[model samples]
Target: MTSTKTMLTLAVATAAIVAAAPAAAQVSGIATAAPDSAILSAKAFGAANTQIATTYKAQLDQATAKQTALTTQIRTILDTNKDGQISQEEYQASQVATNPLSGRVKAAETAGQPAIDQLRAPAVKAQAYAIEQVALKYDAALQAVVRAKNVNIVLSPNAIQYAPPTVDITKDVIAELDRQTPSVPIAAPANWQPSQDTVTLLQQYRQAVYMQEMRRAQGAQAGPAPAAGTTPPATAPRAPTGR
Candidate 1:
């Protein structure tokens, strides 16, 4: 599991590497692709995702609603201060039997989790199937990109320290994949299954999507930026920067 998680971190990063060989004073023939990114970024994957979102809206909504309600219930039980919020101290207290309402708090979580999982199963399966379909074309699309670009060597970004955007062929591979398979079935057939590796890739993709959503939400909550050249509302002063 640790190895899988490590792989997920690497796989989610876009890959690029410098060229090993150069002709005279000029350098060329280097390209890179994060196969996982290529597959996930393909138009087909995004299109299929829209379909999955539509198909599983009810289930996903139920899971989200249940989760939100569970959080409120826990806070209501544990917020003995009646501060209308659960602090770290209160939250920790709820986990142990010492708190008078710990049992009810724990029970709510225990009962809510399985129901939420059941609600989420369909969307998760559909997403996995879509990822598998796009992943199937990765090797071919990569090879095609290599041949067209006359790439000498390609490497994963995780395997190296840094690379320039010009050498990263991820977008090219994504375009190739879009051409090869414009879309795939969002529904998995009975008895259909993905490999363990594809399952891990699905997990990684979900984590990435979750993070993006969080950043977006945070940005929205931050409100619009101050107008250019105008004095902004004051916050804490920062330390001076170095050259």
Candidate 2:
């Protein structure tokens, strides 16, 4: 089951939207904050999202249609008997040489994947460009939020088993990020590339978005959906600490 922290964190923290840096502050009391959430919530992220969405609307639209068709095609193979769900036997069979349908199923998957990827590439790139921009400003935002909130000990939503609502300063952190960068450039040069950290952050952001979707859909995730290009991070920024 998803905890309130994870749910709440994931709700706003899509794309880690990534996480903030390890907090450096005086310690006085304990508080919980999801820096990942804050990073996603920044105004710049929103602005970038709008810009990217506008720029890549056609690609996104194509992707949406392609994804739906792919889902149907894949579902037919996985749910061979139309049982409404894919059984382990069916899934395993689809991958092995034993089933005659295996070759066809594999073929379908291989053929459709590239087409879908190509269609979504432009939008995906734009999304990444925007998210990386937000990540660049995350450290400063974390510090500002921690100090302004007078939080001494800050923990990730993932770390806290339980905490009072008041201690969850994810919103304040986001507000700080907004103040830091109201907007960022959405376009990336052909030579442009994100750092490994930004790449990881983008992944986390996607995972969080997936989790959030599962919660919303009751355990069913759709596709490579966008969540403010979520601040995905393999190593999210740490929250500030108070003495």
Candidate 3:
């Protein structure tokens, strides 16, 4: 999941709201402090998510192709009767018979998982680290801003009205992160099992594709059933009978 800026917590009710008066009025007493942290948070989270998204796309494509091929192979094996199809009963029975060796299939099912984790895990960890680094930078910058304004409490942008352009600190935080971190690859686990969710989803998808093919083959074999009540035409007579 993508990260988000921290939530705002401030009492805006007691704060003064400045309404525009005639140009002659002098503005005074209203105070505001911009949220540099929120800006930094947005930038850091956005960059991390973008990197993660690209990684996820590649992993998803690879997994999907592998799954499609395996489904076709499994379906061919299951429809063993070759009457062009298998009934649900036939399919279930075949699976049961073959189920004794399912450990092999499970191993295969688990094979692609490491690649997926290799793409996803590093992205997650990198984003987490980047978030921490950026937060620290934001706090340091914020303290300076606070000391300059002599404000003890600073609320996020959502809590205030009309912050000056100088108040946003996101760019600085992003700059620091960009300077310190580089994109890194996720390493595969030594013995990571396939995610159950991914396995289950692929299984269901393959089952649907298999069922469709079975139905199509059945349709082809079902052709014209002996033309209603008429008996099937007999084979031609043997030549010269028993000469």
Candidate 4:
């Protein structure tokens, strides 16, 4: 299992790649497709394919209910005076009462977080697995789209300096993915770790996307060069060098 930090890094890198291209370029390219260049919205594609909403709806609802109940109980405890609103002093007092050793208010308040996490771990793991499966499906779908369109390069919409609607194969890729993988099993093994191949591919994808985005951003920030034949503005001759 990849650590949460690694997952966050991958997500950030991917997002950066998608955001690399200048908006002006994309707008200008809307009329024509650059040879072999294609843009896609990975975020949208992932959202469209995620099955957690349907597969874990019941569990999510239960979790939400539990959270609400816990919140009410905590609030009741903090409002020691039975007042409708809890004052800062009352809250502090409750915290001190709960854990005198450590004066950490949040720690005392969220003591049940560990228990909540334990309860949801299975569902969380299952949802993550489903998303991973969808990602794999997305890769295959993207490949098929690339072959069909005879495209040599695929870029996230964020990375494109310019791209025409004609070159955006996101819809096509989504359609293909839906056709090939309409649903994914949300059940995850008790202990799941992605295969080495999957890890390598995921890492490569994150790095590629991040680098492309960074390159495009740098280019965009590099303002246009002085127009050809334009006269350079003359600076007052540097004050005659002191004798």
Candidate 5:
């Protein structure tokens, strides 16, 4: 199991590395989008998440029902004192005997969790991979928008002070992302390893990317039009520059 986890981790690390390659400053910024670029809202991704949530809710219901049944059985066993009330001592003692039954139920549930997880794994994988692909697609679209605008820097919509709605290509990129595939490919073996630095780098990169997405979503929720000519609020101070 540990080996499997390690392998899966490595595969994710690899994908993340590949994704980050294009972000290097050296990568050519020669993209182009129409002058009237669409603004892509982060909320658009929510459209694809309903199915995933439904799947998880069903699994949780099953788990909860199983737990409820086990609780009833345990209660019945502890009601042994016949006083219509389970004494604390009785409850504690009965717990040991009832524990096996509970354990059995739990073990079964625990065992079943993996199966349920396995069943859902592919969908989850696909969703994540698809999200990444969408992000990449957005990146490309944004680059084009910048090039067409004749801008050297493609500032995040939130970061830019007062760009015209027409100048913000966020919407167009999001639409394209939605139309594109949103499934993660599951090639990770149930074995794979790389250097620790690689893993750390991947984790950091993923966190940063997630933060960026979150900020974009927050900005989208906070307004209709950005305040004209106002830069993004100052970000929290960063750690001292690294080598």
Candidate 6:
């Protein structure tokens, strides 16, 4: 009787295994197709972005050149001796001198600022638009790649501590983006202005760059700071203390 019951249990187990085989195969196939923790980086896509950036930079370069010319002209007028350089004395004299040159320099700076601001406004808007367009294209391409590869998870390269090169899909995404969006329009529409958020961010970025440049220039002109623990020499030992 025991041998007959053991045979019955073996038959039931074999039937169960046969029934689960197809389901196990399906699960294995899905696992093979979908990968977890795939990484993508937007930094890999820059060809189209670089073109837009270059356009904006050209505008800034033109404005900078004009400003430099105006500054050079003012400096020439201050160098009354035709020495091609303005001494400290010359700089001080130019500030208080009765000559019309000082007045012209001051007027040029005051008038030029408005023109510079006008030029900068459109350039800033164009840059913001270009960045937005590029970002949209990148996101679309990233989504397409994710779908095509059946990726279960995505992570930015910056956020990952360690990832094998094989798991990075940045190049694949960039290729897809290049095919979808080969170029980005950098021109700003008439009277175009960035959104308040973008404007605030741009203003902050400009301020930071300005402050950094100012600090760099000041440091260059002022020499390095003294080392720590530095002290002035004693003055003849103070002639010794009184008894």
| Comparing 1 and 2 on lDDT, the stronger one | 1
Ranking by lDDT: 1, 2, 6, 4, 3, 5
Q: Enumerate residue pairs that collide in model 1.
A: 15-157
What TM-scores do the predictions have? 0.72, 0.65, 0.31, 0.47, 0.31, 0.41
Worst 10 residues of 3 by lDDT: 232-241
Model 6 ranges with Cα > 4 A deviation = 1-61, 67-115, 190-243
All candidates: CA RMSD in angstroms? 11.9, 10.7, 21.0, 20.6, 17.0, 22.8
Cα lDDT tens digits, model 6, 1-59, are: 11212323553554444445674432221211011111112332244345544655665
Q: Report the lDDT tens digits of candidate 3 across residue range 1-243.
A: 111233233424323222333322212322343333343334554565466557556654554455445544444444547564545654555445356334434454466334443434444343334334444444454455455555544434455556565544445434444444433323324443333322332233334444565566458775311111111111100111110
When 2 and 6 are scored with lDDT, the better candidate is 2
| Candidate 5 lDDT by residue in tens digits, 69-142 | 54444445455556555455654553364555345434544543444444444444433433333343554544
lDDT of 2 by residue, 1-243 (tens): 223234345544431322343333212355666655666778887788777778877876776676657656766766767766656666666666776666766677577656766666666666677877787776677677777766555566565445568867778778777877889887878877665555655566666665665466444643322211122121121111111
lDDT of 3 at 70: 52
Q: What is the lDDT of candidate 5?
A: 0.39
lDDT of 4 at 15: 43
Candidate 4, residue 43: lDDT: 41
Stronger candidate by lDDT (2 vs 4): 2
Native-vs-model 6 lDDT? 0.47
Count of clashes in candidate 5: 14
Candidates arranged by TM-score, highest first? 1, 2, 4, 6, 5, 3
**Candidate 2 Cα RMSD (Å):** 10.7
Off by over 4 Å in 2: 1-29, 82-98, 159-163, 210-243
lDDT, residue 174, model 4: 67
Two-way TM-score contest, 5 vs 6, winner? 6
Q: Please give the distance, in angstroms, between residue 209's alpha carbon in candidate 2 and its true position after superposition.
A: 3.6
On residues 87-190, what C-alpha lDDT tens digit does candidate 4 reach at each position?
65664454354554223334443564445444444544554454456665565666677777776545445444555567777677667767777666667565
The residue-level lDDT of candidate 2 at 83 comes to 67
Residue 71 shift from truth in candidate 5, angstroms: 15
User: Candidate 4, overall lDDT?
Assistant: 0.47
